[model samples]
Target chain A: MQKTWNNKAWFLVLPVLLLVAFSAVIPLMTVVNYSVQDTFGNNEFFWNGTDWFTEILHSDRFWDALVRNLSFSVIILAIEIPLGIVIALNMPKKGVGVSVCLVLMALPLLIPWNVVGTIWQVFGRVDIGLLGHTLEALGINYNYTQDPFAAWITVIVMDVWHWTSLVVLLCYAGLVSIPDAYYQAAKIDGASRWSVFRYIQLPKMKRVLLIAVLLRFMDSFMIYTEPFVVTGGGPGNSTTFLSIDLVKMAVGQFDLGPAAAMSIIYFLIILLLSWVFYTVMTQSDAEA
Target chain B: MARIDLDHIRHAYGAKPTRESDYALKEVHHSWNDGGAYALLGPSGCGKTTLLNIISGLLHPSEGRILFNGKDVTNLSTQERNIAQVFQFPVIYDTMTVYDNLAFPLRNRHVPEAEVNRRVNEILDMTGLSDMARRRARGLTADQKQKISLGRGLVRNDVNAILFDEPLTVIDPHMKWVLRSQLKRLHRQFGFTMVYVTHDQTEALTFADKVVVMYDGQIVQIGTPAELFERPSHTFVGYFIGSPGMNFMEARVDGTSATVGSQSIALAYAPAVGGAQKIELGIRPEFVRLQREGLPVRIGKVEDIGRQRIVRAEFEGKPLAVVVPEGMDIPADPRVQFDTSAINIYADSWRVGSEG
Candidate 1:
């Protein structure tokens, strides 16, 4: 058989390439452009060689925000992954309750980002909020505005309330796909409830748990609007995650070079972490 | 091993079943002996699986009691029944190695690790999976996974009985034969009371000491393969247990003869079918001898199936099949004669015994 090379096929990909360039590549190139150059007043620009990148890397503010983001991601994954699985396990397998439960779980995800933040902002106000008033009436020092610890708790709780449903929904999908035969066989084998969960349910839900963990990690790591609106990065920057800090530097201070450099570094870190997660998970899957 | 007695069991899926029509399993009352191998043979939706589940305690019967060795266990859970069942599709722990999978049932009962190891190794060797013992069950082929499921059941020693529900459905044809034989060998060697459920007649006949033939949520007959072949208690058993099933022809029977169309054939004995609503005479295709002179039949199609030829013919405006040996010549005027010893008389689909 003779093989034919068709160079004309490249024409079909032109629309997608143009779309990606305008949407992603072009904007990214502009950031790269700003990162590698310095600008003065009167539209004068000068070439700067990686100095902004080094400066951002050496700054304590960047490291602190990075640490905060990493810690937040770790904490939420630890809580949400197990919590979601537990909830999904307890969910009704059949009957009228399934749709009702699913809709209720999805309600939190449907709310817009800023609205969630606004709801929590007012809901946690020391003077007027129900939660704050209840806590204060119980003789607890509860003020998100002035106390860094309270602000951190409020932000973490808000993120968990908003994003844990994604995990629950994914785990629910995984749990339901397992056939009833496994459960029947487990019962016949005299497996206890914990053994059933560990051997049958957990292994069945592994793929979805990986997906949930990765999604929660990325989303929580890059979370901005909700925490920004609720805490306003106040209480001495206790809850200022990397995205919040990045927005403050880029949009507030208007330091384009440093901000652009930081953005690239943040993108690289996320890409690297996600790649590590994917490889580790899929490798374990293959081994199993 | 324990004798299992299903005493007047009936099951209905509905919460409140008001009538017999609502029942999934109409009724089942039989006792399976200790160390006996039995097969529940029926077509799909015939309540074979429901009966098996009831026996295994996966589903409690809505009526009647179940006894294991004379102890009432009707209210017992499946776990409390201490029975092992392999499902149609292999249900394996995906993350566990094959060894660990087989050991799981033992470990759950808190069996010591040394005993678990001994039993697991023996089963692994028996199932030809010793080499794959360390391999994850998820990575095995469909047949290997099925072997794992079977091995898990066999590894448990204290189980009252091991029930199989179409466990070889997922295996390849060749592997099905191999696994089925392995199961038979295991049943013989261990003498475990086994109840296997399958719709395939060959599987049922070959694997079980007694085949319980079911139809429309009722047991038509329970007998050995030879007895089922010779004397089916119901027309359904006669129809369901053969390659080309029994031929049933509408007939009018006198004391010692049955009239088919204008020809009256001699019977070995007078069947007591008095006041019967319907009368049918059934004889296997093997017993319908084709010859030069008998009741005249118009030949339709002759199918040569390697060892024998199946002559499809119309006998007095009714379809009939006659099996003839290979290379046998069909006479110019072909007809079929039913072996008098093999003729069975049915009254309203139920077989009629001989008169005193």
Candidate 2:
């Protein structure tokens, strides 16, 4: 069948094309502009092809911040997936309890990221804050401002509280969409409770689980504001993740070329990793 | 291999039932014989599924005990009751292969692997899923998935009965015939006590030895397919069992004879019971004969359905449908005669006497 070659279809796609240009393409062109070009003074620019990229690629500070970012994302994903699914499974399925659980789960998510950072910053003060004071009272050395381990734990815990609800909501949506027939059929089939979850619930929740993972990966990978306010790259850069380091280079030290190069690299890493996750998950979903 | 006795069972979905209208399933005291093929035939929301669930122990009756071969199982869970069920929509483990779907019940019961393999293979062949057994069940079409559901039901030998709740609804019409025949063949081969629920009269009549007709929330009549057709015990059964359904006309009855408007018709039997609030003359289209000289009828329309032509007409001011043989001549003055041996007199919805 020959489809008449009408150029009108591209006209229909013009809005979406313009949207992508504004939000993604135009900004990326600016990053590319800065990445290979150097600006010394007002309106003075010079072509310095790949020099900043090479400097950023070789710098110890860049490598350290990247390692921190990678570890944080991995740890966040590992803790959130299982924990969210467990909470979703245990939440009440019907009546007033469902609304109560949903509202409670959504409460942490509704708070602004900066506000979360401020709340945590004050809440972790060893002199007056409840958590820090309690830890000190318990004869434990706990301080996010001064201790690397404590800072990491505090950041991870805060992230889980802020974002685990998104996963819980996604998984819960998956769970309720399953018709009552499957459970009844399993009961008649003499399936154990664990078998029911393994065979029926998990299989049904696969698609939603993919979305949850991807969303969490993208959000956690690009995380900045909360940790920036809470630790301010903290107690001699122990918790200085990639975003904080990029801000320091760009805004703090005004190293425009290196910061721009590093930001482009960071964007590419997120895109590549997200694409990999989507391809692997959807491929397995298609197979099953 | 068990006789299921629903001993005075009643169910109400509300917290505290106050009246009969509140009940999902009204008091049902009935039993299904071992190895018998039965159909719970009714329109939608007629409590057929509720009854099936009760028998399977997915639901417990509010009023009475249920017994399987005289062993009380009303309080037991569906797993403890040891029955098999096929749902309206196919419910197979999507992540598993077709073979694994069939073997699931057996594996859950911890049956030996060799025995499970043999039974699964046999069911695969029986359901015509042998070639697709290695394929994942998630990718099968609706009818194919339903066949896996049937196979799972058949894999368990220890199950007391297999209950089907309109399992062929999602199947295409052509596949529906094939799957239904396969089901009938299975019932004959293994003689597993099977109770099928369906709103389609053709499916119920063709699939079961006995058809239990239900209306609202109560069973109107329970009889063999032949009995249901020839002598429906209730007006609802008479109206529901036939292809075009039984034609009912307002009438007055008095001992073997019934008067419909101005014309008198002889009944198959005399009613020993007293007169009731309503009396109706019931006769299937098969029993209403079109003739040259009888009570005059105004011919309306004729629908040719392959071998038979159903003539829609008006007899004595009431609408009527009489099926005639194809190529039969329509008389100039068309009139009709009701077969005396087939005429039924119903009083207050119940057929007073059908023995004659």
Candidate 3:
């Protein structure tokens, strides 16, 4: 009741507060505002609480895109996490080969995402491209433009090519930080190769694996630019991830309400799943 | 248990090791009796760990061979050599329980579940980790995790020898004593041939029946702790073994007397100093007694260290230390007498003749 008020203190934090409001809070609030309302023409809006949300939840197009997003993320994680670990493990631990390998691993990561999409789009053309023509020359039916499965495969491979290096770099960082003593001790313990990986390498890499899983999951789920540039969500919506569908709904069809609502849902899904992934991965660390 | 022999073992980290200086370990020829405990004591980068790694088969020697009970195991892997090693920092499987960590070595060889259980339980009990057997090994204190590391080695009954490379460095001082005594007890209880490597002299002297003192990548002397204190085979051993270590002075020898500057001290044996480029007198601080009469010395400082008073002095322009028991009188004009029985003469850093 006797507390003195010094209003000048607010001035100290005003810049950061305004910065956050403009960059993050404002955009997020705009999405939330649009999510629960109907907007039409110049500055006209109507209260439509939860209607857009229900519409988005009920749409088949949304569900299919969601399923596609989930499947793509799962498949990529299943392949890339283990594959990245294998590659990192096999990479030279020292000598001149180390820098060479590091530079090569970083190469794919340095290319712009759209450039990656463009590279694969041109490279997968059956008539002119090396890979496509080589496959055709090998008597295989490979046409990414015409077949849905081929398009999905092309997109998956493209994503893997573009982003597996992130996983490799992270895992390599985790691997190299491990002191040499663990390996020496494992060797002295008569541990098999599998046991060493399981008991030493895997446990040591847990933190990085968490970041890897979260990054790969979130990035792959919200993937838009690369596949959009490459397939344009063609072959009858086979590769239309949530981000692509959201873009189509908002920009192509001019359906702002559903897109904004879906955007909120998408953000929530990422936040929720990331929490789950983080908790599941890091729970043992807390116990330890 | 099997006796282990290292035959002229030498190792160099670099491939093009043409000079003696290039070798990380130089010509270590030694043997460990079956069921004996030995410690390799040396300064950091003096190749104690390199020699330990070689014995554990983690490093193959550049020259020479290793034998286990007369069987050549020079090229064998550590697993094949049946060795267990604990590292400087405790190396526990961070995700595994203490029991499972202890059981790892035995399980790796596909030991029967019952036997593995029996052995794991025995080791857990022996290491006093039975209370924490179910806890994660990674979550325990450093010393507890080290106990698990030790248990993993001890769990395997078939190992040729178990080696420790400064395994107690991460442990707290009080726990270091607990673990050292535990190790000593384990050595007595199981009679496992052990080779411990450390820079700590107290640990070496207390843990090993014979301490192998190394200097400059070479084992200079291997002897009982008493022999190392009484007569160091090399000047390095004398300098590295005791609390403040042995005090050595540049000297000249003739008959039974060794002359340091203008002071002549009687020696136990007359070392033949023929053709020797350098001659030195080595004596432990414990043997240098301060009395009212003898060679003149100027007392510099007296340090009271609980049970012993280390009298620092200068004799013939050379600094010396004398360890006098607590409550021992220090004369206002203090001079010193070197224990004639304990005085060792060194020529060119090596012991003169066979008195060592």
Q: Can you write out model 2's per-residue Cα lDDT over A1-288, one digit (the tens) per residue? A: 986998988999999999999999999999899999999889899999999989989999989988998899999999999999999999988889999999999999999999999988888889998998999999999999999999999899999989999999999999999999999999989999999999999998999999999999999888899889989988789889989999999999998889999999998898899999999999999988
Q: Which stretches of candidate 2 lie over 4 Å from their true place?
A: A1-19, B354-356
State the displacement of the C-alpha of residue B187, model 3, in Å, after optimal TM-score superposition. 2.1
Question: Candidate 3 regions off by >4 Å?
Answer: A1-9, B354-356
Of 1 and 3, which scores higher on lDDT? 1
Q: List chain B TM-scores, each candidate.
A: 0.98, 0.97, 0.96
Tens-place lDDT per residue, model 3, B227-279, is 99888999888888888888889998888888999988987776877778999
User: What TM-score does candidate 2 reach?
Assistant: 0.97
In model 3, which residue pairs have backbone atoms overlapping below 3 Å?
none
Q: Native-vs-model 2 lDDT?
A: 0.91
lDDT by residue for model 2 (B1-356), tens? 79999889999988899999999998899999999999999999989999999999888787888999999999999988899999999999999999998999999999999999999999998888999989999878988999888888889987899999999999998888988898898888888899999999989989999999999889889998999998899988988888899999989877777888889887667864465888888889998889997788999999999999999999888999999998898888998998888887777888876434
DockQ, prediction 3: 0.82
Ten contiguous residues with the weakest lDDT in model 1 chain A? A37-46
Question: Model 2 chain B: which ten-residue window has the lowest total lDDT?
Answer: B266-275
Give the root-mean-square deviation of each candidate in angstroms: 1.3, 1.9, 2.2
Arranged by TM-score, best first? 1, 2, 3
For lDDT, the strongest prediction is 1
Error of 2 at A243 (Å): 0.6
Of the two candidates 2 and 3, the one with more favorable TM-score, higher being better, is: 2
